[model samples]
Target: MRLAWPLVTGTAAMTGSVSVLLAGMAGTAPLAIGLGVALLGCVALLAQPFLGLATLAVFAHLDAVEKTLFGFLPVSAFKLLSGLTVLAILLNGPRLRRNIHDALREPVIVAGVCLVAIGFVSAIFAEDKAMALSSLQKLLSLLLLPFLVVVLADTPRRVALLICVLVATSVASALILGADFALGVQLFAQSDAATTARTVEGVSRSSGGSDYNPTTAASLMLVGVVVALSHAMETRQRRVLLLMAVAIGTGALILSFARSAALSFSVVALLIGWRHRHARFAVPVAGLVLLMMIAALPLIPAEYWQRLSSFFGGAADHTLGRRMTYNIIGLDLFTRNPLLGLGPGNFVHHFTDPEYRHLPGRTMLGRELHNMYLSVLVQYGLIGGAAYFAMLIAAMRHLGAVIRHPASEAMRVQAVALRFGLFAYLLVSLFLPNEYTKYSWLLPGIAAALHRCNRLAWEGA
Candidate 1:
């Protein structure tokens, strides 16, 4: 078997080399180079499938940057990595089947399927079939990501490595945003106009790469902060690195200038502090935080303070009033359909109806509902919304199980961290329609993987 494997790999490499050579001779050097690199990556992923997961983790945060760098190429880096990961998993047929079987049994997985199915059914009944189908296709593609994580991250070591990769990418994203903010440039911005125009008190908001707006970027940093803080508490060896991650993430979150994200992060921080109130380091950490806040007060931009202050109420602040208008429109739409919805992705289509045009709010013809739960309820109606919430509840329950029955201290710590991170995500969702975001599913997938790993460890013990 080993001999056959080597022979196959060697033949494939030789074929790829010849192909690249021919392409290079044809005056397509870039294409040839890309082909060669892709071939090498495929071989590596096949040899060690976990590398595929790590690569995906990196691209997930930097996809916009990848797109900018590889604009000449027709392929998407994120999609390519996903395809490669799937192929790598498929290489081991037995393991793939076993993982699928186990993953299917998870409550989160089941509920996720139900939600997708409901979406599909809603799509069939949508007013704009083309738009609905397109939206559904995207949702289905993203929905597969969590299941893929569950299948690939089977071991505790693999889970830990994946978490580290996520954290590193998050920190890298923060640094990118910080540099952009400092230089007054949008280094890896998804949209120049949006980035430039989005300012508060003359301070522009910074975004993470790859379709992440300020709110989404801030939410991502918030998750990283919680995860890093928890890891710092769990292990002494990597405390410095983890603490640095927390600091950088917090900085990025503030730079985002996203009021809801900031609020959610504050709530999570307080919750964490309260949870560990009796711990030995609690007092010291509280004192350190107080000192840090005092030291940072002067350094913090006036714009940030102004923006946060607007969160309460200000004559110049129209964000809250705008969101309220959107909510009223969204509710009206819900009342119109009340069941399967106007159909998937039809909210914007129906927003400008003659009946709604007379409403008091500004003309937000194509804007989203700005709330995840409201979006789901308006688009998929009660059934799909129920399934979506059920999936999240199931994921939280699974994480809670892991926390209550951890095989190791590390496992317990991770469970707590993930639960808080998930809570932060949910809290942020109240202000943003993030139902289709990758992290929304990835968090739950990691929770499920942790639960399974802990269960397996108990069985072995």
Candidate 2:
């Protein structure tokens, strides 16, 4: 923990520098100051919860005089912090270095390397070299993720600390949303005009004027719920903390207005019930949830319901129509470049609306397919897609063992609780696009480590 101080200092310094730069900028910078701040805020929002609230207020008052200055704070912060983090790691080589051979044993590291290789090769022959190179960068950049897995692999207590951070983040976000509802105005807002227009009452999106797309938020909250549940099962003394975590996470997921999250949380809840073997509580809880959902239907703003309802009855402009269009275009792109697909992140350029037979503009009648599987298919091609899917499945199998293994009652239940949260979210992500979720990809690493650790424990026994 003492060694971690320098790394934290470097990270904070970078964040502070970027945040100041963003806040100081005047009119007509390439990066919008407000957008910059909000985006970068995502990085530290977990580390410093109050910062988000501060960003929201600052953004609200920003005008042309300071708009660009503050808009791009988040990006600036991310760039600075990421650079500093890398520098710190390099400077502390002895502390940061790992046995590469040993590290590759983790499934996630292996998958990441494979993906990076595929991306690089695809870039060499890519129809658009720049796009290929960019995708390759993103693929390789995630290498840090596996390091996080390996570091935390042997330390369950550290994992518990991370869970605590997540719980705190969720609670803060929920509190922010609650404040927004009470004020009857969007807070911690971005200038996402699109999100603002579509927003209903009671629930506020993370930022103002931004799309309330809850894919990331929902996924994060679900993970929080899982961690909380896991903690609850592990320690009787922390029951209150665990229960508060569950309530905050569950409440935030609901307030998010993300149907996908709702579905995912439902699955997680069921799994939790089953794991606890509180069979008697299952039916009643389900019934209550159903009642809350139904009661919530009328309570949601009409416009909000209109968007949600469109999912069921289908939206002519969006919902079904948009998904079908994106998939059709994606499939065609996949067919053309089946070997590498269109290069990661290249799909948007290749994507077109079949109905209008044209590329979709921001204001046009088109949007991303609210699905992750389809996005992978379009970006990674069949080969990359297969590798990715296989990796996910393999991780799932490894995680499955965590709960299934014959262990002490408490550990078994803890494993069950943990896996339930992870697996349920994976299943729910089918309908929402969270392809870039750090946790989603990181879970495989965690699972691989867990499997290895479990094996070692058994062998020693």
Candidate 3:
């Protein structure tokens, strides 16, 4: 009876507060509603930090949705969620200190910090201070992602859950893209006309309602496919669901008409098959993938085939030729400033210089360097590039250790999955300048977390 009275009184107080908010801000109902939701989310996150982390993962993939829901406000939804999550973590002082200590010990984390430092240092010398500082701010914001994952995903189960959240969000994104294509709608399309109008041989490419362009979307889906494939191999309990995710993700990858994604997916598949050749599930999985490909082949649009074929057309292909031109330009920039290189985010500014005007395809001004490594080298020079490479290498080494550890099969399987996932990112990075991509940092963070979990398990045993 006492509990009932408290609940009634709490409900009355909440109703009164909400009524006041609505009555006071009748013209801004959406804002009021958003505020209410954010408040509730904050409370929930404080109560369960892991849930907040998972929510962040989901929003990371659904960036377009986040912008739609909260773009009006001065603050970003991601930043708000991150702030709340950090506050939640801070509430537990001992755990936060331990997490910070462990995170600092990670070589990948250290290398990442060094890379960021190099970026900031380069920014200080950048000719376009505003642009460089702006880019650096975004980069710094993204840097929090890895630390959050490392701290919150401390146990094997939590790591797995985070992985599942990633996979699930990827699957959801793929499904949304598929629906958009089938319905001939812009359900999740980028707002920019140039991106939406992209075409190959008279066929329009679908970006599908996300902030990501087709290529970026394909790369993100590829990560999901890799992780899902690994999970499929490790457990029978969710085999069907995982396979469905793989199939849907592959479809989305193909639908995006990204040649690099297709190539990377092929390479990762081959690597996984070779690694698990002797396993009992290997042949069946291979056979299923083969069947899926065969079934999907007839349904593929003709333009997609044309796009894929262009990947091998070399100098004859306009896009490939332009990419080659960009590479040369990037090299020229690197040579001109070989030591510290061009200041951060100054590549686009330099692209307009008269000296580069003689280059073929110089008409396409403001185009980013398509290649990630070249972008880093051109922006931060050899030192920063080395630090970036070191971070990736450290992540790969950590995952390799986890894979070889005497841990549970599931953990080992996830490690292998993440390693291949990172490999996919690296392969895609060859074509796309996604050096500062959240997913890139996220894979390493998860790798570090998994490595820590495996080590702790060993020590406990």
Candidate 4:
């Protein structure tokens, strides 16, 4: 999969750096460690696919880095790793030139750029220009995501590896969450004393931090469920790993007590179950899931249960009421600035404006519309929203085409999972404000990458 010198050189450099750090660099140990990690990561990036995998792994598990000695050192490891990964590809030069061209040509990738351009232009009118620009940066980071995915997961083997990395990371997080569930405490947040814990009813949600708090954690676990389920259906060899992932992921999810996540996970599970109605594994897995559900039934807090049952019983759900109010506010914002809306990230600032004082929302600061679609609609208006929507539609169509006319067995398997993932994320977006996050864009990148594979022979390219 790669040459030997990059590894050898990287190892030697890292070793020599450690030697120096042990001698006279102890005073600047933090800086030394950060530099060493970056160097080593760059070397790993010599193998383009590994760099991408490492980047995604770091992205997925960066929250858990708090367990490390230098976790709280403000190292910006994710940014460093991602930047180095891209740099490494550039260093590959002519070898990767064609791949780079292919990645850029992806419709999803083009659509993402257009979407960002619209947001960038919209930011000029932002009530808080700085905040809108800040949000744009986040969206811009996401735009680079497809290139990374294409370079890393260009082949079937790499795509499988990608899912494996996600599964392993998700399981680790789920285990942490499960431990918290059993001990009734968030041991992971002990380092960040100032980090407020989010709890529903008497249970503490498994929010590692603001980046991956309880809501995000639960939603990610839901994504994990899809990946694991997809791999399980794709192969019979690694049944145990997939089952363990599904089990741990389900446990972690229940603990989060996130209504939207729970509902989304349930819908995906049912859909997958129906899709695999004739498969041999479906029956047993379904039974195990049923058992897990029954066993965990009593563990569900009455408060969460009431929230989940809101639709059936018409219970007065506070969260629902709040989201409704916030959404109405978003509508008003869109109506006023119907062309461009409040700007990319101006919603929170405008939410504080005097004109919206009559709305049901009480607090203005740190306010989110709850619905990502509505958020995009309010901020980017119809044009930007349509561009983003086109991206999603393109991804769905690509995946659908793959399923209908897959180039290979591996392509079919991956397409099935990614198609489900797209729907699952879209469904969860109605509750979770995830439109701007890196996670939202990564799946589409994979879908586009698969589409590219169908056209170009990526398998042994």
Say which candidate scores most in lDDT: 1
Query: In terms of TM-score, which candidate is stronger, 2 or 3?
Result: 3
Error of 1 at 5 (Å): 8.1
Inter-residue clash pairs, candidate 4: none
Model 2 per-residue lDDT at 272: 62
Candidate ordering by lDDT (highest first): 1, 3, 4, 2
Runs of candidate 4 exceeding 4 Å displacement = 1-39, 47-49, 61-75, 189-202, 208-210, 280-288, 298-303, 310-316, 458-461
What is the per-residue lDDT of model 1 for residues 275-343, given as tens digits with 9 covering 90 to 100? 888989889989998998898788677777878888667536766777787889999889877878777
Q: Please give the distance, in angstroms, between residue 3's alpha carbon in candidate 1 and its true position after superposition.
A: 11
lDDT of 2 by residue, 323-401 (tens): 5666666666677778677676666555433444663432253245556777777777777777777777877777678
Worst 10 residues of 4 by lDDT: 191-200
Scored by CA lDDT, what does every candidate get?
0.79, 0.56, 0.78, 0.72
Provide the RMSD of all predictions against the true structure, rounded to 1 decimal.
2.3, 8.1, 4.3, 3.9
Q: Estimated TM-score per prediction?
A: 0.94, 0.70, 0.91, 0.87
Top candidate by TM-score: 1
Q: lDDT tens digits, residues 77-166, model 4?
A: 566556766766766656777778887877888888888989988998887888998999888877877768876676666766665656
Worst 10 residues of 1 by lDDT: 1-10
Error of 4 at 298 (Å): 4.1
lDDT of 1 at 98: 72
> Any idea how many clashes model 4 has?
0
Candidate 3, residues 1-461: lDDT per residue as tens digits? 32433444456458756864985568776667666665566556765677778877777777777777778779887888888788677765454677778987788778888878988888887888887887788777777888888888889999988788778877877887788778776676555631565645755666653577778777877887888887677667688988888888888887777888899999988887787899987788788778877888899988788777776672145767777888899999899877676777888888877888887887646778889999989998999889878888888999989877748888887887777778888899899878766787888888888998899899889
